[model samples]
Target: MVQLDLIELADLVRPEQLVAEILRQNPQMPVPVPLEDLARLAGISKIEAFTSEGFEGALIANATKSQGAIFYSNRGPRPRQRFTIGHELGHFLLPWHRQAKFQCTAEDITSGGNKDWEIQANQFAAELLIPAPLVKTRLQKLKDPELAHIMALRDEFETSMEMTARRVVELSEYACAVIFSKDNVVRYPVWSPYFTHRLCVKKGERLPAKSPSREAASDPDEWHELDAHWWLVERRGEDTPESVYEQTLVQENGHKVTLLTYDPE
Candidate 1:
């Protein structure tokens, strides 16, 4: 079992290293390596599901060389399947990961960061697919940031929409946030340090009745700027202090993704 910290793992095999090693192993393609190839390189044998129910995914036990398998239900989208496989691979490689066959839900893979181990697995999966260095390089090329840029990155890297959005919120030079809400209730949100101190959006809080998320049901652009207190708690009888850039993305199932972006006032 290899033991190392997050920074050490980042130093050892970044996304570029992973890509380079994949290409070296399979010279037929210069584009990003396939997920199966990534699994094979990481020593996982096969990715298949058990004849079981109520399981989103799992890792097979007792494989040689600490290797494992990734099991998933067939009902998910292709991008989700790829993300699940990457998450399971994270468990397989990280020494601090639990040994049990991980049965994950969509929420688990997306918002399971309350625990240290779960957070580590999430970081591992993110870095494995879209290294921060690559993202940083790409961000350098763009003058204006938007959801289109994130989507382009996702398609370029062949990763999922959620992963791309999360990465952008993490790496954006602008003050940015990505809120995941279902049924108009807050689920999970990734925020920058600027928002961390003052912009507190509590879990399960209903969307602000006056926010664009409630009324802007038609615009599907990449980004927008709006009032700050519109999404933050306002002091009673105080004038609205700041404004924020609000980018709203509505999924097929009424899931709302609102990206709050603002510069320090």
Candidate 2:
């Protein structure tokens, strides 16, 4: 493990609190959040590629969580690496994550199972890389919400489209939703807090046959009009609303992201 510059670490326990302290220290933090630099600042001594076949990232530190080395696999998409780095850093910093070493798999980083430690690490990574305040401020300055806006955020924040999309949903005031699908099968879906429509989404559910994400495959990242029922669960006695706008961003392979907005006349 190569040595890096050692910086003073903080005593905050919660993931959010520690990130707040980091932001407080680096008031002029830039977009895309110089993540590795921040990791080094938080006491990580070295970060190198890990050749482990299935693990996304790992942390090597003593029982007291000092003198840390982070490892990330080079095989995944480049966008995911930063998050993996942030995850290991989380494991290194959280006082209660008492493990001397952490070898986090893709599932552990992306979607943790029953382990609270992995879940907290994921939270730390998300909040550290994409601060909530920044997202809210950026969204307020933008015009009408569009999937293109999310695409722009993906680039600006240096995060995967799905990650950026989920962050936006967590803070957006508009009644909207994001759906991630592959080959017309829903994999993950998230809707804004303002969304009141009962969605039809279920893991492994077939995408609405006529949804724009599939029908307008030729034009990627374009918004189209559709009925709210396209993604909403219909009420037993009421008709589904009309004029729900959908903007779909087609991704590599069979992946697709559809943004839905509920606006009524």
Candidate 3:
């Protein structure tokens, strides 16, 4: 792995800028970026498992944030641990994430909500590990956006479904959204910038019974169509698309992912 010079990258403030600079410098950086090495070069002294209660990950750094060590839980798959390291590294690299210690829960690792710092850190981590340009290039090659395509890319990127799904939603030209659930309860929703309507399903709400994600069927991978109103809460002046395309991939331990798409028109 080619080492990055933090000094050369110090001027970048936003997560996108910092990630772009990193890729630019290491133009040959391989797919599924060598995150651990990148973290070390960025001054993370160590990345080790921490089994402490209530925290999935933590970062402890010196007063000026020159150096630090990341302790992430061993609870989930390796992909999640890698993401945690990337997330904490975001805390270390971004000048404004100045806390001497950071303790992150699974929710923090998963969704940052309106907390700008948490949001930024998660942004940094996703971009660092998955690299948006790579994702876009791959999307361009796919004939259509679907759960199957994202699933293949997820394995190729060696990332969790949440990371891969959100990245696709962020960059896909198709108007679309991704919902992540555990045991059929909506954990969060991520929609592309082009998707304008609000999904009726809020976080923690049970997915509508008619939704493909809630159905037990012979082919979970098949795309199903439903009235857009089933999933969307329409605004006062608009008509929700007559039908939206839905596909689901049930994951390990009842974790489920569903993708919704429609014509950009």
- TM-score of each candidate? 0.75, 0.91, 0.87
Quality of model 2 by C-alpha lDDT: 0.82
lDDT of 3 by residue, 1-265 (tens): 7679888778888999999999998988787789988888888888899787698889999998888999999888988988888899998898888798998888888887567888899999999889988888899999578888888888888898788988898898878999989888998999988888889999999988888788654255688889888998878878778888899888777888889988655
lDDT of each: 0.66, 0.82, 0.86
Best by lDDT: 3
lDDT of 1 by residue, 25-44 (tens): 44444223266666765667
Candidate 2 local lDDT, 209-243, one digit each (tens): 77767753645456678777777887987656776
Per-residue error (Å), model 2, residue 219: 2.6
| Cα error of candidate 1 at position 11, Å | 12
Off by over 4 Å in 3: 113-115, 217-220, 233-240
- Between candidates 2 and 3, the lDDT winner: 3
Clashes of each: 4, 0, 0
Give the range where candidate 1 is weakest over 10 consecutive residues by summed lDDT. Answer: 1-10
Full candidate order by TM-score, most accurate first? 2, 3, 1
